[model samples]
Target: MVTLKLLLAISTIKQWHTLQIDINNAFLNGDLNEEVYMSLPKGLTVSLSSCADPPLVCKLHKSIYGLKQSSRQWYTTLSDALLSAGFKQSQADYTLFTKGQDDQFIALLVYVDDIIIAGPNLKLLHQLQHSLHARFKLKALGTLKYFLGFEIARSERGLFISQRQYTINLLEDTGYLGSKPAKTPMDPKLKLDNIQGEPLADPSQYRRLIGRLLYLTLSRPDITYSVHTLSQFMSAPRTTHLQAVHHLLRFLKGSPGQGLLYSSTSSLHLRAFSDSDWAACPLTRRSTTGFCVFIGDCLISWRTKKQPTISKSSAEAEYRALAATASELTWLQYILADLHIHSSTPAFIYCDNLSAVHIANNPTFHERTKHIELDCHFIRDKIKAGSIRLIPVRSSLQLADAFTKALSSTSLNSHISKMTVHDIHRPS
Candidate 1:
């Protein structure tokens, strides 16, 4: 997903043309070197040879959909073909292939059989598509309006990627299309727990709903905190948990088209914000880490997750969040380098906790922090290597604050806009 976002960001910046292709029956194109036999499918009458043919069975020559190795075989075939075409596979993301340099550069990202091709050279893209079509059954999807549930809108300003229809479909399926709109996805005072509500008669529906919402977070970072909160109760969701899910649906109904907008004028420099909520989880008393990464003004990556261990202090929690953000920034730098976008300036990690900032900058380790020594060491190493810089910021201005806790409408709206989230299709 990071690779895809980076591709779109670069395309927006370079004014490149983006195209999509779908390989027909992609798994069927795999060449099988092993022998496999299957019972003849029902209703297919094989011609009897001299009326003495043994009980009929079929021998497979190529990969089939149900085979365990089908996906790997198909990818091997695709990789071989792309590598043969002089395209270099990205070390950061093997699914990405690049060719040429400068204005002639081309990038092709493949997820299974669905491929997104982008480049400044239109002729080269077409020629490559033609070449792919020659080797495999290819369906050229012009202009890349939709791919993998993300509706992409392109203009001179930039690209807007959303799951508007997906969101509406979910709302409709859950009977929330006509529900009252929610100013926020979750109530600021709501504290959910496993034992607070009655066990649902049927928990499968709750599980399924949470699963879909998890996918929705790909574009709707606004609900990421709420979704992450509700997801914890999936095992045996209660009435209260289901109600929270419905509340989230109401929020989605308000702006089904809200999504990330990658601005064309955005710079290529990387920056990030890290935050943590101390003892946020009611049941576990564990801190929650939240972070968002941006390439220039465009937000590309963000996450809301519970800390793996209990934090002894707020500083510990905040430092852990900084370490998590630093790791992500390092990864983004690698990916940016793979995309041929490099910045000599070290990426900045903004934290609202001054104690965490001081600890990160201080070389001396204390006995109280021995349990968290690993995280501390990792963060200091990043800072010393010039890969990241830890800076303290005001809590009110921390963009990742939304990810760690439920916020008032005003605060969420402010962070939403700053994160480049737009609702061009919001209902009146």
Candidate 2:
């Protein structure tokens, strides 16, 4: 609650003020665990002979932590309390509850037992909290300093999300804190082939290493591609592959605090960029397709992988990529519909390949597109129905370019600048 108030303070000047609230006796207040019974808590069970019946186990009239249904009962209790107090849950996030009008909105986010309270209208926040406090015990934790692992900092630019401390711990745990730095997470000159190299002496150790690296991807886009490549050889890893994995750890050492930073001033429109490099895999002769989805300014999801089928033409490769991206877009449309946050305009899809864009917008039978799979035709239907509109972007500005293939440092940095990252905090 304090953190949200702080966020409102940064964004709204004095127009918004937050109220800090803590639900007192939150767990104890809930009606709970009718099935639970205990022997008189160690002190009162000694005198059973005086009564007509043997000393009966004390019945639990309320919920306690160990019982299976404790969590459900507690949630139901809290939910009823809030609903009675003029609050309604958000359709998008079940954890979020809201009340009041647009500018005067009061919001509460519940985390298990802890609750965060926020509102631009301070008077409303307090009255709600006061009513709750009158019924239950409550404590106020002034301002949110840290929640859900990400450190909070509200400023002119926006809310900066980073995991500087967490990254540092990862470096230390992997024994890479003192390793020399590398310019990039991946070496552009290297080529990976699955030739079934010498197997690891002990496979469990390699599993542990990859497990840690996967978690690191949360903040490090630079490593995402390289980590993905190395992961393929987990079953039979060679010394060369192990060295490549070490190189990634060294890259982490140089910038242990780097992570994604989601800022406030970002576009809310649903836009996706899809691109594919034709016949990029030397061994398989398969193409690679990469796509990124963004909501407003915040990046929601991204993926890069080799396509299942070999494409005879570049247009074929791009059409396959479009099909993959279209599938993702369709899922997002349904998600938004559930939240009642439908796009005001048709969702925009940006692709650098004119051949693929033409195939999507028009259903004409060019000899090249005839061989494309039946699944690929569905994208054209979506375009004609006005669910997704395809737009042509110049090669240089194509954001999906990074995910499709390796690029020069200058080009790589340019593409990185277009990412959702707002800042990197090194724990200073």
Largest TM-score belongs to which candidate? 1
Quality of model 2 by C-alpha lDDT: 0.69
Q: Which structure among the candidates has the greatest lDDT? A: 1
Model 2 residue 250 CA deviation (Å) reads 1.8
Residue 41, candidate 2: Cα error in Å is 21
Residue by residue across 260-326, what tens digits does model 2's lDDT show?
4445565446788898989978878999888877666556667778899899988889888888888
TM-score of 2: 0.71
- RMSD values, in order shown: 4.0, 6.4
Give me candidate 1's TM-score against the actual structure.
0.93
